[model samples]
Structure formats: structure tokens, C-alpha cells
Target: MQVRLEQVTKTFAGSKNTQATAVKELDVTIASGKLVGLLGPSGCGKSTTLFMIAGIHDVSEGHIYFGDHDVTALPSDKRGVGIVFQNYALYPHLTVWDNIAFPLLNAKEMKKRLKQRFAELSPPMANFKAYIQRLVEEAAKLVELTAYLDRKPAELSGGQQQRVAIARAIVKNPSILLLDEPLSNLDARLRVQTRDEIKRIQKQTGITTVFVTHDQDEALSICDEVIILKDGVLQQQGPPQEVYDHPANQFVAEFLGSPQINLVGGSIKANKLYLGNEEWFALPESLSDQPVNIGVRYENIRPDRENRKQAFEATVTSIARTGGTSTVQVRLADGQPMRLHRDSDDVLQEGDRVRLYARPRTVYIFNAEGEKILQC
Candidate 1:
């Protein structure tokens, strides 16, 4: 289902006689049958938006729509939405079969209401029963849980239990599926395994899914589109790669990367870009003489041994080797820190003075207010 949040807002009455806004005039759209991510820091309203869409929390203002249906006023049971919680929310006493069948039984009342809504166009009850059974079987197979049908959630591993929960949610064939940090409880290896499993299931089932996560890697890896929020306000929304490559603002640039983008003090003077006391490159004609911040990704900055042009002379402050790559932290002449990603074999000793050059195209320019001024 195509899900849209139109100017939605939510607030909580604080104990100090003030209102705290959980979501601030947020607007987003998820295309039908696609996985979209709501990514942000803790207390940034990502979960609140998901809750609102799932009908678990009422919107303080504005509306929500699933396709053409105005579901803003609907109750959780009436919304035809399925949700997977961080803890999985499965019953320990119930077997996997009962858990997966729970939604189907609960959906009977919903089906009655839906029948009332579309009595003239609705299919017969016999067909609906067959349809629900097929959906349950298909959902269980999608998550590879058919073999564990008789096992209780307590008897399953964390990953298997999670798959059972996913199967339960999907068995109802909800128009929109809301997942709130579903992978947070799994081990590192299982998290990776389940992440791919969720993506594969979404693709094959063509179910519209809204994933809420604070992990940037999780959002970037599995989502087709991403909506970023900060301080309860919408910051940016677009395709995952587009948002990462061309962050709308500095917050996004800093939040979306692993090693984080390096922000160095720079200036545009007489149509030239200067870092510290040396001129790095000639500035574009549109960029006048002004103070600016130069943003460069870790991988884009390379340690140069020969060339000095477009380079920063810095002392290596620290080195972190993580099996596949090493991150070298460098302190510039002005005391600003920057990082470079290199192979594990390409090691550098601390206190060694090195020259680093950043790819021109990978560099970003931000104004005083931290909004991106130049994407390239």
C-alpha cells in the first residue's frame, strides 16, 4: 500500500507545564510494495512516526492515508496494519503455528468491517478463508519458518523467533508493515543474516514496509528510500544513495557515515579556496570570498607522499585497524581533526607528518548555518 503522512504532528504534555513535540509537521510518502526507512538519532521521533502510522498512537494533528483510505481516525485493529516490535512480542507459551495464526483470527472482525465498507465489491467468505490460509503459508515460507511450525518461541533461537514474529505479522497480509528496530536484539552475525532476510521477504512479497532504525548502516543497506528526522522535525527524505551522496545539511552528512565526514575550517578569498594558511584550489566564480566549512568523506581523503597541491600537512594522531580497513586520524596545523580510510597494510605511525588530498568531487561545502552550499 502507498502510505502517506500529511503534515502529521504529535506532542506530549510535559510535567513542567510545557509541551514536548515528538513529531513536528512531518510529511513523507512510501510507494507501494517498497521498503522505506525512518532513520534518526534517539528521541528524534522516528519511532513516534512509526507508531502514528501503525495507529498505535493518535496524531495530534494532520492526517494519515493508506493508499486512498483515510486511516487517521481508525483504531489499531481497524487499520489493516501489522507491526513487529523490537522485542518480537511473541507469547512464550504459544507455538509458532498459533502465533502466526493469531493475526488471522484477530482479523476476522476487521474483515467484517471491511466487508461492510465494500459489501458490493467484496469476495465471498469461503474464498477469504482460502486466501488467509495461503497467505499464512506463503508468509511462513518467506521467512523460512515452515520447519519450526510446532516450536514455541522459547524453544527457538533469537533469529528464529524473530522470523516467527515476522511470519505472524505478514500472515495477515497487512497493507503496511511497521518494523521498529526489529534487529536490535540479535547478535552481530544474526543481525546481518536477518537483515538480508527481511529485505528478501519484502521484495518477494511486495509488501509496503516502514522500517524504523537509528543505525545508519541498516537504513542505507536495505531501504529503497529514507526519511531523516532530527529534533522532532523532518530534515531530509530521498533515495538512500542520493541522500548519502548529497546530504541536504550537515546533520545528515554527519549522521549517515561510519567514520563521519571531516569538517575543516576553510575560506574563499579572491576566487580561491584556502585551508589554514595555504591556498588549496581556485574557487568557482559563484563562490565569493567568504568563510566556509569543507566537508570530506573518510574514503575520499587520500594520504599523498609526493604531491603537495590540494593537500593538508598534518600529523597522524591515531590509527584504528578493523580487519578490513584502517582509519587514520590526523590533526591539522589548526588543531582540527580529519580521518582517512586505508587498507590494513597501509599503516602510518603516530606523530608522523603526512600530506593528505581530498577528491574534489567528493568534497562538500557548507555555509555558516551548516546547510550544504555545494554538493559537488
Candidate 2:
């Protein structure tokens, strides 16, 4: 199913009847059978957008569509969206099998809906219970939980319990799968493992999935495309690498990366750009001279002992080594802080004077309004 949100807005009533807008005129199109991530920081309205799509939260304005069908007014159950929440929301008293089959058994007009959806593959009404059992078994097997079919939620590990929740959500074969920070509860290693499993299962099932998350790594690692939101407004939406390489604005550039992009003060004068009073690069003469914020990724800035004509002087303040990668912290002549990533084997001591050179094509310049004015 392809999900589309047209000028959608969500607002909440606070004390004194004040209105707080959660989402503002959000227009997005989620491609069919693709895993799309709604990614942003906390309170950026990512979860709000997901809930609106699931019909759990009502839209204050505009419309939502499942393919060509307008489902703006539909309830969550009526929308045919299966959701797996952050906590898994599994019943501790129920076995895995019962948990997976719960949706099929509890939904209204289950027999009729099942017959309509799985008519060609299903058996007669006399074997309905057997049919439901087969569905539960199939769901469990798909999530690699067939062996734990009789086990309760409390008895399973975090990863296993999450798989059970996923299995339950998919048992009904919903047209759209919605996951709300599904891996936030797991440890780092488990988060990676479970995310890979999610991508694999999504590929096999080809269900249109909307994943809401605040973690950039999870969003970039698994999602086909990511929609970045800030302050209840859409910022940027694109493939992870594309967005990282060519961000639409300063916020989008800074928000997507892991170690985060390094920002420094810069100015353009007479078609020349300067970093901390040191002439660094030349801009197009057609551009006007003005103050600008220069952004460079940690990997884009290289530290060198040998002085270069284009490089700026900086002193090494500290170094943090993580496995094979070393993050070198430096301060410029004017007391501006900057950082760069280098090989852990590189030898550099504190108080060492080093020249910092930024790759031309990787440099990003943003205006005072936080909009990208130049990206080389």
C-alpha cells in the first residue's frame, strides 16, 4: 500500500484551551512496498505523524490516503494498519502462539475478513480454528519464534519478545505496517541485530512500512528513504546517503550524521571565503559578500603537520580513540572549536600545532537564516 499525506496538520488542546500544533501542513508520499522512516529528535512530531497515519491521532486539517482511497476519517482498526509499539505491548500471561493469533481472533468480522483476504488459500469454515492456528504458526516461523510458541513474554529475551510483537502485527497481513520506535528498548548490539531482521522481514513480505524513530543510525541503516522533521515541520526527505551528501539546510545537515557535522564561523569578502580571518577558498564572483556558517563533516577536514597554502592553523587540544578511529579535537587561532576523524594509528599529541584543510567539494555554507547558500 502507498500512503500519502496531503497538507496534514495535527494539533492538541492544552490548558486554557491553547492549541499546540504537532504537525504542520505535512505533505508526504510513501512508496508502495517500501520501508520509510519518519526520523527526528524528541518532540519533533515524528511519532505524532506515525500515529496520524495509523489513525490513532486525528488530523486537524487535510487528508490521508491509502493508495487512492481517502482514509482521513477512518479509525485505527478500520484503516487496516498493524502497529508494533516501542514496548512491544505483548501480554505476559499469553503464550507466543496466542499473542500472534490474538488480533485475528479479536477483530470484528474476522471470519469474513479472513475469507475475503485469504480465500484462495484458506480451508472451509468447519476448519476455521485450524486455519487460525496455521496463521499463528506461520507468523511465528517467519519471525524465527516457532520453538518459543508456548513460551510467555516474560520468559523470552528482549529481542525474542520484540519478534513476538512483530509476528502479532503481521499475522493479520495488514496493508501497512507501522512501527513506533520498535527498537528503542534494546541494547546497542540487540538494536543492530533486530534492525537487520526487520529489514530482512520487510523485504520478504513487501509490506509498506512506516518506522518512527529518533535514532539516526537505525533510520539511516534500514529505511529506504528518511523524512526528517523539526519543530513540527518537515525538513528534508531523501535516501540516507543523498541527504547526507546534499542537505537542504543547516539543520538537516547537522541532524543526520552520527558524530555530527562540524560548524565554524566564516565570511565571504570579494569572492573570497575566509575561516577565522584566514583566507581559505574562493567563491563565485556572482555571489555577494556576507557572513556565513561553514559546515564540514569530521571526515572532510584533514589534519596535517606540513603547512599548506590553503590550510588554516589550529592546535590539537585532545584526542579520543574508539577502536580503529580517532577523533581529534582542535581549537583554531581565534579560539573556535573543531574536530576531525583520523586513523587511530596517527600520532598527534596535545598542544601540537596542525593545519586543518577542508575538502572543497565537501564544504557546506549556510546563511544566517540556516538555509544552504552554497554547497561545494
* Cα shift from native, residue 145, model 2 (Å): 0.6
Q: How does each model score on lDDT? A: 0.86, 0.89
Candidate 2 lDDT by residue in tens digits, 71-147:
99998888888899999999889998889998898888655798665656634545667779888988888899999
Candidate number with greatest lDDT: 2
Per-candidate TM-scores read 0.92, 0.96
**Off by more than 4 A, model 2:** 118-126, 305-307
lDDT of 1 at 272: 77
User: Model 1, range 272-327, lDDT digits (tens) per residue?
Assistant: 77787778887555676778888889988888756967777889999887886788
Q: Record all residue pairs in model 1 with backbone atoms less than 3 Å apart, i.e. clashing.
A: none
